[model samples]
Target: MTNINNIQSISQILDSQSTKKSKSSGPAQGFESLLNSVLEKTQESEQGIQATELGEIPAMDFDIQTVSSIVTDKTDKLLTSLESYAYKLDDGNITLKEIEPMLEELNADAASLLEETLSLGEDDQSLIDIARSTAVTAKTEYLKFQRGDYL
Candidate 1:
């Protein structure tokens, strides 16, 4: 009876020790290997992005510069149109009726430019606002001339 009891106790101890070893062996190494693989893949993705993104970065900047150039051209056109409109209004030889159509076209062009400027990013918004205000001022001055109360 004493021998049988000792054998059962030894069997239980061995069973518990085997379970602990299995727990430390199977899932723990698997999880560590998975983590290492994920880290390796992430590093590979970062390296690939670094290789491919340099050209893309410059092209994006070029597009922004192109838009800025167009905005500058429109700004020049708007200022010139306003100047000509005011000049014709102040001239004594030219009749107001003849120049009115030209002023209207200039106003339309300015409005179109304003719409284009508004499409730009926050970096360009201040310029867009100024252009809009300038257009309004031109329109107001033209109306003032039409009323014979030019100031």
Candidate 2:
């Protein structure tokens, strides 16, 4: 009877292990694939933007308001993405690898915006500097979380 009970307990444990593995496997793979796709697209988009090229002042007349609006829209998207990921992190669902790439993308977006803003006339410099500084500080905190040094 004791041998039979031990066998039953072992079977229960094996069943539990298999169940947990099966449950986690699909979601884990999906999350990893999503992260990969986001990273790849972000890198491609950043390359196409070429923030350095924006540094050159074009001879043609430009609308600063239109340019500022576009920059604000991109920055808002980056911030929104980071905020969503932070919620996932708070839930203990985000892995360090996932956080790192996302943080890097956010940093790049902020840097690109700053580069474009700096290319503008001196009148807009102060506001752009403030925005850039805030973004840098936010990115630093994000990096800490990604490194598991802070929450």
Candidate 3:
């Protein structure tokens, strides 16, 4: 009976030792390999990014003269239309009702053109104020005409 009890104790000790060794050794190899693979991939990606950026060209600057000429052409057309409308109004060929819608449309177009012509970082306050005033005047005249003030 004493010999059997000693053999059972030895077996239990050996089993616990084996369990501890397996638990420690099992995850160590897998974790080391995973960490090495992640580091290698990160290094490779950084090299690729640096190479791509070095191969890229710088952007060219835009031509200001070309842009200015285009803007001048558009402004000329808008002014011509506005002048023609004014003449028609003065000659009494067109009523306020007819001119009001056209003036509103022209005002909107002129405002858009002015914004586009004035690039970023430039002030266009005066031009915008003039456009707003013209729009208000046109609206007031239209309202007056509608109320039978023109007749």
Candidate 4:
């Protein structure tokens, strides 16, 4: 009872034809192409990240007050080390076991202070000299203690 001219054919109904041409810049059409594109983009992003990470760091400038504070801190550490030794020595019953560590600490602190103060202005010459002398004194005291002089 159907009219033949109005009836659609099975082949026409299942046709896969495109009305327009695909652009070259359109999404990749195959699995291999898609995977390759993803890999290329990832490599590009990674290169950008690497360039940023490997960039040179800028130099820092320390002002006079900052430098002075650093030097003063080192000097304070040296003085504290010397004071600890003095207190232990004044304790009147100090043993070699106690003095050994204190002497080493005083020696280290004095050496560091001397090194730091060496770069200061001529106004700090006295401080530099004091640091040097303290270092020497600490070394000598340590040597004497090691030789059983205080035993």
Tens-digit lDDT string for candidate 2 (4-80): 99999999999999888867858787988899987877677678855453356869887667656665666677668
Q: Of models 2 and 3, which has the larger TM-score?
A: 2
Worst 10 residues of 2 by lDDT: 49-58
lDDT of 4 by residue, 50-93 (tens): 44444579989966575456677776776677777778877878
Q: lDDT of each model, Cα atoms only?
A: 0.75, 0.70, 0.64, 0.68
How well does model 2 score by local distance difference test?
Answer: 0.70
lDDT of 2 at 76: 70
- Indicate the TM-score of model 3: 0.36
Model 4 TM:
0.49
User: Model 3, which residues run further than 4 Å from truth?
Assistant: 1-65, 120-151
Candidate ranking (lDDT, best to worst): 1, 2, 4, 3
Model 1 error, position 103 (Å) = 1.1
TM-score of each: 0.49, 0.45, 0.36, 0.49
Candidate 1, TM-score vs. the true structure?
A: 0.49
Clashing pairs in 4: none
**What does the lDDT read for residue 144 in candidate 4?**
80
- TM-score rank order: 1, 4, 2, 3
Candidate 1 residue-wise lDDT, 67-107, digit = tens = 65777777778788888877887898888778878867776
Worst 10 residues of 1 by lDDT: 51-60
